[model samples]
Target: MISRLPGLSLPERVWNTARRWAVAWWRILYLGAVVLVLVLSPSSYGKGTRRALARHLYLDTAPVLLGFTVLAALISLVLTRIVVVTALSYGLSRYALEMVIRVLVLELIPLTAALFVAMRCTIPNGAQLSRLRQAGRFDALRSQGSDPVRIELLPRVIAGVFACVTLAALSCVVALVLAYLGVYGFNMAGLSGYTRMFGQVFSPSVTMVFVLKTLFFSLAVALIPMAAGLYDSGERAQPDSELGGLARMFAVLLLIETASLMGNYY
Candidate 1:
């Protein structure tokens, strides 16, 4: 029962691909609405649900993020030393602190945190959720009058967003401190000039954009994988959907980084 119309087959394939992307985007939008509701509804932060999620997010993820924090600190310290030495070598030592704050704090930490949550938590958890669906646990939950998206998936999504925001903020603070130490050592002699430079770099407009960028990064980290899981419209679970989700997420992340660069530099 196969009809091989070659010319029509080509057009059909093209339309199919287009339709697939369309469906994927629609699913993403729907998930965005769900997340918005969760954000606006105070019930989301109720005692039992948020406690379990936050406890899991904080306690369980703390060890991983602690290790990650040390790693990021080391990397930031190395990069700070390099930027400082290079600036001093070029007689641009005065600009080094500004560079450190802009590059490491505003740019690197947020993107790195998003990627860490994506790779470590989101994708793997999504794949596992897919497996659960494939194993008929989805129906099992439904049989108990439990909606998986609201009860189960939302927590993971919220947790991922929380993880991204938490890690990014914490890492940026650590990097800022390390940058100061790298450029000025333990003494506070250079503190006044450093504070002036920080003020110049983090003006109100720049701060607003930074907050917006971080918010977008958090949404992207949280939404993509879970939405990908929702949109796995195949007969069984597969990696193809997860891989496509990652590609899409990173594309958005890159765009965010590029926009931040333009905002900061241009």
Candidate 2:
């Protein structure tokens, strides 16, 4: 009979309502940010602005790629260890590498790296904006002859996008190496099939689409969290606000993946 009662108490109900409001606001902010990026994209065309933007893109992305390469290498080691141990235990060592590559490199590693940065860096990007908003820094910058959007937010957006691309690429490479070692035991015979599969999975058009999708994912990941942070209204930021930012980031990441999968497979 007691089990028939409501699953949530009054405080929980209030919390849930607040959570819903925060989520809705996050969606609105994400949409707005995307629109803003589209409007500002280089396709709109101004030579000086385009050059500056390109410089920022490369500068921000290069270091991130290097960092991600090292991190992905570490993750690859752990994953390789697990696959090898499991395969030997199960007497299926030959199949282990293929499974590891298929599951880890092609899917999980890139996705996980994207999520890691979205949480680690993107959330802080939003929080920084929130702090700026609270401290009247935007106004001060404007008064002191600065375009806050271009100077502050655009660099961050570029950095986030570069970080995602570099991390994904590095993770993919590391996973491939780990898969090969795990499967072939350092023999050269597996190279032919590995190359064939790699070519098949990474066809030219597919590669282009993957790159574009990663860029979109990076843009959304950075934009949404920052947008949510901007929702603070000078009062103490709500706990639900940051959670909402995270939820939106996850949602956007999934949306980008789904769209990419559909384009590639369907």
Candidate 3:
């Protein structure tokens, strides 16, 4: 309607889009919170469910993601060398480590991990859940006195969170080591400077933000796919591809990263 007005409609259209986006994300966060609560409950993890889920989630998936760690480290090494060499040439070596940590550890690693989980785990999982629901498995499970959300969705969400956290942490550790190696050349002379630079960069507030951002990343990784999968859980609905869920999740991931960047820098 407003597009007909061109100039006048531009502002109105932007306002409408922003309002709709805010509402959509708020609803997503509310649903995510509800799912998290269910997963956090003691009952969600049956007698051996938590243990079994952990083994499957951590042990089984960790090695597969180690490849990502190696790749991340190699990339980090390149970036570290570039930053160090450039900074040294420009007499900005003092700022090199801080830049490396901020870019790699605080920002890049977490986003990469979250995206990897989103693609490798959650999106497919959501599609599978959608198909299962379409097949009446959910109804059968519920009718048999089984909790589908707890038994099925909870594991995937928890596992997604675990996977994101593990990947991000491992990548950050690798990047940190590479940064040190690149800047110090296997020597101890820069250790004091490194510690001081890191401490200065990661003040209490900055550290809190980093933690909160990582938590949000993990939550987004877990919640989006499950939320998307459950988008049409009602039996009365026609079967629909969970592609919408994956798309929405990717959109949310980008938004989360953008917000994190703005929060940290602006």
Q: Quantify all predictions' global Cα lDDT against the true fold.
A: 0.79, 0.69, 0.76
Task: Name the weakest run of 10 consecutive residues (lDDT summed) in model 3.
Answer: 232-241
Task: Tell me the tens digit of each residue's lDDT in model 3 across 122-227.
Answer: 7777777777877898999899998777767777777888888888888888898889988788889989988888888888877887888888888887887777
Candidate 3 error regions (>4 Å): 1-27, 233-241
lDDT, candidate 2, 1-266, per-residue tens: 01122577877667766665656665556656664775477543356445655765665566456676777777777887898799899998866665666556656666776777776676777788778877988889799976666655665666676777778877787778866775666789989987887777678877776777777777777677767766553334224367766776787778888887787778
The best candidate in terms of TM-score? 1
Winner on TM-score between 1 and 2 is: 1
lDDT of 1 by residue, 164-187 (tens): 888888888888888888878999
Structural RMSD, model 3: 5.2
**Global lDDT of model 3:** 0.76
lDDT of 1: 0.79
TM-score for each of the candidates:
0.89, 0.68, 0.83
Off by over 4 Å in 2: 1-67, 84-95, 144-146, 185-187, 203-213, 233-240, 257-266
Kindly indicate the candidate among 1 and 3 with the higher TM-score. 1
